[model samples]
Target: MEKRLLGVIDATAFHEGLQELTLHRSPAAIPFGGRYRLIDFVLSNMVNSGIQSVAIFPKYQYRSLMDHLGSGRNWDLNRKRDGLFFFPSPRLDHPVTGVGPLDHFAANIDFFKRSEQEYTLITNACTIFNTHFFPVLEWHIASGCDITAIRKGGVSLGMYLLKTSLLRELIETRHETGYLSVRDAATDPNSPLSLCSYPYEGYAAMIDSVDTYFSASMDLFEPEVWNQLFPRERPILTKVKDEPPTRYAREAYVHNTMVANGGLIEGTVENSIIARGVKIGKGAVVRNCIIMQKSKIEENCIVEGAILDKDVKVERGAHIKASGKKPYVVRKGTVQGAWMNS
Candidate 1:
């Protein structure tokens, strides 16, 4: 399947509800699971499924995305032959609706024409899952379906598998077909394409909004969810950051939390995910939060039901809490002083 299947990830779609987190970066580059970026999950899934030739289409603030991916060496995609390819949209001002827009693909049609892969797996960069697409490919071939959309419980997971030739046809004749994207073509009732759904009975979550993102992050605490996502055989890969193990101070107290490397814990933490290089000062109490990489919480602060983005600083004696409807999002690289407590 490595030689036969090609992976194309659409990283351009933006959700209005996630604006707080995506103000400075593309949605695909948003940090997740303490260490991995949002795109890492799907990209790793493709690599783990033996797809060597992968292409990423990104738009709107992709500098961070490029910085995170670099040469795709972390996922072992840097190769002399068909390796990782990146294509940014030529028209950044155009509005894109779905996962794989035909116009964007049309911009770089030569890539598809030159590729030797027999089939293509097009997916969104946001859905979190660990799936083997070879089985889906086999199912698509056996069923003689023109397009196969991977679904969980009858809901589309924004993943599709189809022939490379058919994808090219869709891209070239998009205006005539009146299909703006693969999603539009598959979901349209009047389309001539034979569409099928491959039911995936695995753990999958599409992070499109703040609520969904927070819910998925909290779900990582479950043992079953944790095992399903990070199994030993199909590990989720990410950029390598060499850091020492997290250090816990004598005054620190923690329980039921996931703390990444190079963090200093001096306060109390519960039911949270702490990323690398985070610091929790003495007398701070953090619970039900996702503290991103290099964020800090000073002494005597109380933070709960919040998401502190990368490099955020919570000043001393501050108290921040959610309203039980949505997690309080502290934007990236900002400071939360005591006067601004909520």
Candidate 2:
């Protein structure tokens, strides 16, 4: 079979909290687990699955994403038939707005229409996990699904596999009003037309048209429209278990070297990850904490269950306890919990 064209959508803002160290770069460019960029996981997954053609949709703060991706050479995506593409934001003359994923779908309709492939894979860049999308694609085709969305339990990872023809038709049929932010329109009831009120009703409409919708949450497409379209259990629902309990945040870093002058390293680190250029002063104990680059942990300080961002300085004799989705940083003797800059 001819390989299907795959497009990865890395729709994450670099400015999200605790993302400054990596935000100056795209989230995709943020360093993770010691060496690999977050984008590497997704791109590696795509390549390993045999999906040849890929395009990255980068929004603002994409300079780092571009610099790292660099013609997709690392992923071996620099070939003529199997090259990577960077889809820049549409120009003002083109005048596209509210350009969410679906809008990106509408905007790039031509790419799908002209491609020889029958299917497309769309995914986000926020989460860190390894997946073999070929199985999902196989499931999508074998089940005769027009659209298949991949979801994990509790959190929606924002991945989807769909038929190019069906997606194109949906975009065309919906026309200019095809896309809208659910958060924005949901907040304002007076908003003219939500994606809910559109020709397809909602995401379920598209999924129901298919044979199945797979998600870690069994009722992945359990939209209010479920009643309008089909009976309960009408659509084949499948649950995908977490491959290895996908974990994020800074706690993942521990026991790694931080390069810098006067870098004091005194800790018991085993299989832990750390960033570059961090200084652990003498008599300071760092156990299982992610220390970002250029952070200074002063002497006699005990840092346990904590994550420090770049340039954060811990005072002498200060103690830290980590408890929250956010990272902990000490700024000028004041300890506070905040999102780290990428």
Candidate 3:
């Protein structure tokens, strides 16, 4: 087990262009694949690698996030001490506003000061990839680096390991100055922070926008992507839901689709991810779509190239058309069948 260590899930910035999917939930808590949340990838990695304690910093629309994460029992961090911790925004005292990296840490100063953990593993909640942090920690230890970050394509996944004492010094000593763009500052030659980068050779997807989210969602269709993400060696953990196997009627036609448990398919579905408990009524045609949990498509409806949020109900005999450039989306729990377009 990776003892004397802590995890930080930084979701202090709003992810743009997610539309209805992020209306009432943080992007991290947004559903992915057939049944997992976007945050599950990171959380699963943390637990899989034997790191127990974690503190999640939620930004906007965190209600659903709270519900999903609960007590973090799914990840098995529900211990008597040094378990899962939820830190609200520092601005929660006054009014709602944007949170910077400095403020983000300042709010949870106690976590840094009081935790027995020597090393802090900081990471963003939206980057999806399975990884073991122990090796990264070993690398940081061997290199004597002040900060070790995992990067792919010039973007730091925020998965970094640094001495807790160093992080505390940066916050308390530099209290007057703000370091929101720490990534930019890390690249400065004059900066004293000894930074190192670790190359990630795996399926890494940053779901910050609808375009990337759609692209990554579609990528799950590929055999290579699916195998690497949900490989036999490492299993992604999430909140448990005992849903029965998906039932497809005799006339139902599904091709190259991934339907999760409790789904009832009675129509034609092609090249889509149908999440848990979705109901595709008879004569409906769903193609190139991501229908999230518990959404219903009534009889004879034609849905193509769209993303439907949780509990959305598309009525009978309606036609909703979207494209890769612009996907038509129905907001969460909003009854919008033929209501509008993207």
Clashes of each: 0, 17, 0
Number of clashes found in candidate 3: 0
Worst 10 residues of 1 by lDDT: 333-342
- Candidate 1 residue-wise lDDT at 215: 95
In model 1, the clashing pairs are: none
- Compare candidates 2 and 3 on lDDT and give the better one: 3
Question: How do the residues 1-342 of candidate 1 rate in per-residue lDDT, one tens digit apiece?
Answer: 898999999999989989999999999999998999999999999999999999999998999999999998999999999999999999998899897999999999999999999999999999988877889999999999999999999999999999999999999999888889999988988778898999999999999998899999999999999999999989999999999999999989999999999999999999999999999999999999999999999999999999999999999999899876679999999999764433
Judged by whole-model lDDT over C-alpha atoms, candidate 3 comes out at 0.81
> Each candidate: what lDDT?
0.93, 0.50, 0.81
- List residue ranges in candidate 3 displaced over 4 A: 92-100, 181-185, 338-341
- Shift of residue 256 alpha carbon in model 2, Å: 11
Predicted candidate 2 versus true structure: per-residue lDDT over 80-101, tens digit per residue:
8757888755632333232124
Lowest summed-lDDT stretch of 10 residues in model 3?
92-101
Tens-place lDDT per residue, model 3, 90-199, is 57443222222656677668778888779888777888787777878887889998877788877676677778887777667554444553443355566678888887
| Candidate 1 wrong stretches, greater than 4 Å | 339-342
The TM-score leader among the candidates is 1
